[model samples]
Target: MHKQLLLIGLLLLVLTVQGQNLWREGEMQVRVYVENQAQADFLKRSNMIGEPAGAFIRCYLTPDELLHIRQQGIRYEVEVDDLNKMSASMGSRGVPNGYYTVAQLHAIADSLEQNFPDICKVVHLGFATGMNELKAIKISDNVHLNENEAGILFDGGIHGDELGGPENLIRFARDLCYGYNNDAQITNLINNREIWIYYCVNPYGRKYMTRYNANGVDLNRDFGYMWNGEGNSSGPFSQPESKIYRNLMLNNQFVIHCSYHSGTEYISYPWSYRAQSTPDAQHHLMLAQMYSQSSGYTNLPYGQGYNGMYAINGSTKDFGYGALGSISWTIELSVSKQPPAAQIVPIYLKNKAAMLKMVEMAGYGIQGVVRDSITNLPIPALVFVNDFMCVTNNPVVGDFHKFLPGGSYTVKVVAAGHQTRVYENVVVQDNQATTLDVVLPRDTGRYAWRVISTHIAGNNPHDEGNTMGALGPPDNIRYSLGKNGYAIIDMCDTLKPGNGPEIKVFENDQTPENYMVMAGATPDGPWILMGHGTGNQEFELEPSGLQQARYLKIKDSGTGQSQIPDAGFDLDAISYVYRPATDTSGIIEGFTYIDWNVLIEKAPGTEIYYRDQVVYSDENAYFRFQADTGSFAMDAIWEMYGYANCPVHLSPQQHLYLNIIMEWMEPVETIAANNSITLYPNPGRDKVAIKSLTNNPLLSLLLCNAQGAVVHRIMNPQMNVDGEILLNVSTLKPGLYIVVGIDETGKSASGKLLIQ
Candidate 1:
């Protein structure tokens, strides 16, 4: 009898510890400030992975921890206990009154299968770590068989206390099954797409009225992406709940995925570990906009995650995108975890359209097959259109789908050890899917440099949409102040080519400024500063212990002396010399212009006079003469349609500036014709030698500023003096200027002059 009493005492102690594991209902939760990754790391060591609050991060702390934080002089405040709440307050709004019991949910699933056997099937998707069954209701025309149709998976209740998740998913499934043939759009989506609806992922937590699973783990934070062995879970996939979903992602091809939650009305996208733009940013933004517009919920702007609500690592949405390449999204369904019972149905009805629309968009792009030419068998490959985006074919079926805006695209198919195939002028029409089947051949040549992505920062009005290979010294240059501007160049694969990593940037003219060169695998980088230099010059970025790198970000360091106002480092062309570049002439060239109106002016100026106003027409360029300070701002405004149009605003201190400046005739034209005036060593450090190619004696030469104001003049220069008439250009500031020469025969020629 004494032993039995001792066992009972131990059992009571275990129960008390279990109670302490959970956040108490109605208990106040405080958000403690974390200054940097170090402070965040401290909080993370204490199990606060998903509770990021503001600029840096926020640590949700217990009362004792809160006091410790205060004592440590850490800033903190008590906000609404988002996790803990009164049970009586739950389901108080006009929503489903009571939470679903485990048995009741199973019964509902069973009923769904029984009632809609033709289009729905209930399947048990393994079990959570707590041993609670995870269930899903799959709705499709042929629910029992696998189809080539696009697949979409929707799941909720990854957070146990967020009842809106499971309830909304359950209701959406029920509505889809019920409205299948009766509703036209529902019938269309069901027939075309395979939909999987998973409800109540954390059943043990839900059953016990807790915020975590039976093991006190947050299932949503247990994915492998950015999982740092912190938070409530021991490691990635440590919880069976996360393992089940991970398995599902690996085994099936889900084109679209959504994870539902509550506490805010938002639709969040990826890069949860760090704030970076998703690789499929455009597609994610388009679909997110569609979902938000259809549901009328707040759409977090593109390139932002969780509405900057928090910095959560190892999240479900991030895992789906970072690992599986699925276009995943997170939906914060309501302001409360559990809204009033009466509001549940209303919320379900409101989000119904978005749920259906998301699935529809999965199949609304170009879909096709990739195959082996010799064997005539399906082969997995990558499909690229619009240089920025790429989609891979399924391994089993060799099928690929790419959603794109309506336009003519040159679809390129690439596979390992295979010669890439290019299809030209493949038109993708609105609401139509274009099919293109490609068969790759064996490659016969050695590997070479291939551009993966390109990004530029500054006010460049043209050539922004061009690929890295197509960008060069002839293209429009982006000019900004100091180190405020930058560019990102990505390669097709990481390069560790033994020794001497070389990078080259081609500029339109010689303007010296220091640039910070960095290398990494991603854009939001823990960047490594590799080199710093002036002007457009070749850089060697070889550093010790750093071998493989696929991304290069260049920032203006503003270390070199500059004669041009606010002129940072400008790049016209860039290349990574991995294997001695084979071709360097694909550099695309366009007319350069500056638009003065959009310039972010530092000081007040008077509107001088206007010449051209229409975009990219005869008057696409303008000159703004600053009377207050004898400086001119030249702007090139063009209707280049799809190109990045950055308004050119030249600083007053920059003497040689033009809003729009393009050579009327090619420089080579002067060489082709005998009647030419040549300026040797165009970017002269001190003196420039000018020669008259024709027999006519040199008449007069006038040097004018960007605004046509004469800066210097010379008359009757002796022909062939010092082999060529040497002009002193050391007094002139560095910038673009005009050189006009007139002969005795009334013949005249004008050429661009560069002062360096």
Candidate 2:
């Protein structure tokens, strides 16, 4: 009994000390709403907040600075006043209630190991400056040995106050181990991958409910890559907690990693210090999109430069990427710091599929061995695709994992004291891992080739404009009348015919169309026909014998058939496939992705025009679409679009464009309210009443069958004394019909009319 009391006293004293050191001298978290860019810039200049949530910037301020802000008449609200009190309050809620205390967390970890001895093992990851032991769990078929499989690390509670991370990770580990026999997905993931979940990376701050460690250092900002600010006492890795992970990462190989945090619900990838895009932007986006889509969370890819969020440096994800070759990402779990216990399971369930998907994706891409030709021993070599700069190989296993969006690439494998091996025409399929193992011979001469630059001909103005739909500049622009519109691309330098095809043309291949490719040394071409292609597919230039040229022209044959008027062949991008010099950045320099929400917010004149009439003046329409669409268990639009009511994906870019078009065209809410097309007794048994609440006279009302055939037509409908037009839907078959109303201004609104 005395020992228990002594232990309790020690815990109380520790908490007291941690609470005192939390804010240190002056610190308070505030959420300030800024009206314009100037106000945002003002907060930025002060260096208070790292990122912004739309117009609201979350700031950690001092008392003196808080006074200055109020004096400046800046509007602000306190998010957390006293860190100690918040921590204390969080502790009172107990394990899974709000957050678990250090003792409670340790107990939970111990329980997990005891409960699932077959698959789970708790690992103590050394200790922090506060003498608290950091821990993680290893779950796999054989956790005792280095398995010949991909490695995944799920880290949480990097920041002390971010309770959701650790909580969700604990629950996930439990589910994976508990449901192994019953759940097929869990069984597959555990059997295939070596998974590690570090429940809390920073235990010191977790005790105090602060963002920083015991030494007043933010562990996240203590990494080697792009680290800013003065190191606390112990220099870089001076913090014992960071040093442990750093050493572990250096020694082991982790192919994929996801770091969890709270504050905002987002998925941010590597290269956060600069505005430059990652080499594997496409792959990262595919995974990031899948993660958010799986969780039904907001999808934001890459970093602040593209996302409009604030720039964060020296983060765990960047360290894992820049220092190690792991494709690490940071997932902001929720908007709240420590979500209630009831919300924890729901949040985990939402993220469970995404977690499984990440593991599955890691198992994908190209996986193979790099070895010596004679010895047949593994050689730690750098495997690289010319297009993406940062993506490399896992040195420990001599295996390279490269996930490229469906295309062909020139793969180069290089190692110290060895001849570089070059594999030409390596084809990568989407969502599938391709294997290519190569043996490097002794050191030889370096192969060199100039980088080719692409430019469209200025003469074809209509053919090169980005605004004519083909999904901005990256996907290029659209062109119609197959024979009339042709785009000529200048390669900037003379091209020599290599082993395989030298040029690639992106086309809207949905319709049966053929494009004629002609090449010449100059723009005023004495041209030769390179080849012809059909369908909505990328056209690769297969040079015959030894053909070489600096200019390539893609012309529509007009022989291509299309039912839609003016819908000829649409060109996306034209690039020459050149053997690149040393793998470097700036190969394909352009934004490859754009989020739908960001488009709605930033695009000028972004009014939604419905069927060339009734422009939606409200922004809520976008929100409604984002939330309403998508399937319950699925994270992506692919599953969502599978429903009968959902849109179709002819092409990813065009599908999004068409969805936006449909969002504007379909009289969802804005049109139904403004244009006033109201149908009473919606699931009408016999007769349905229609009302037009607009000043414009109702010109015509048409009722169409499920196949869109005109079943009933009311010409020049007259309103009754009560301002409602009664329609006899009784004669219509007991099925679904489209109710379309035309106004005097030629504005048309459509809704569903059901007959039973």
Task: Please list the C-alpha lDDT of all candidates, in the order they appear.
Answer: 0.59, 0.58
TM-score of each: 0.52, 0.54
Over all chains combined, what TM-score does candidate 1 have? 0.52
Question: Candidate 2, TM-score vs. the true structure?
Answer: 0.54
- Candidate 2 per-residue C-alpha lDDT over 137-189 given as tens digits, one digit per residue, 9 for 90 to 100: 88887554334467788988878877888888988888888888899988988
Candidate 1's error at 682, in angstroms?
71
lDDT of 1 by residue, 1-756 (tens): 699998887687567644654553334446566555555545544555344323333344556666666766767677555445443244333123565666687788889999999788887788775457888888998675444567789988787767787778888888889988799999999998889988878887676555677676777777765454545666556777887887676545577888887766767787665545665777788888888888845443333573464556568887777555578878877766667767778878778888888888888667786764432334446566755435556643457776665778888776643577778899988767788877675442212122222222222223222222223223443433323445455443454433344566555465566677777754334578777766666666566234556666667674543333444566555555433221222211133432233442211121222111212323322333322122222222222211111223233344434333322222222322235556655545687777665656668887776444567889987655444678889989997666767677645555555676
Once superposed on the true structure, which residue ranges of model 2 sit more than 4 Å away at CA? 1-20, 34-46, 49-51, 67-75, 88-98, 114-118, 230-235, 296-306, 391-396, 444-756
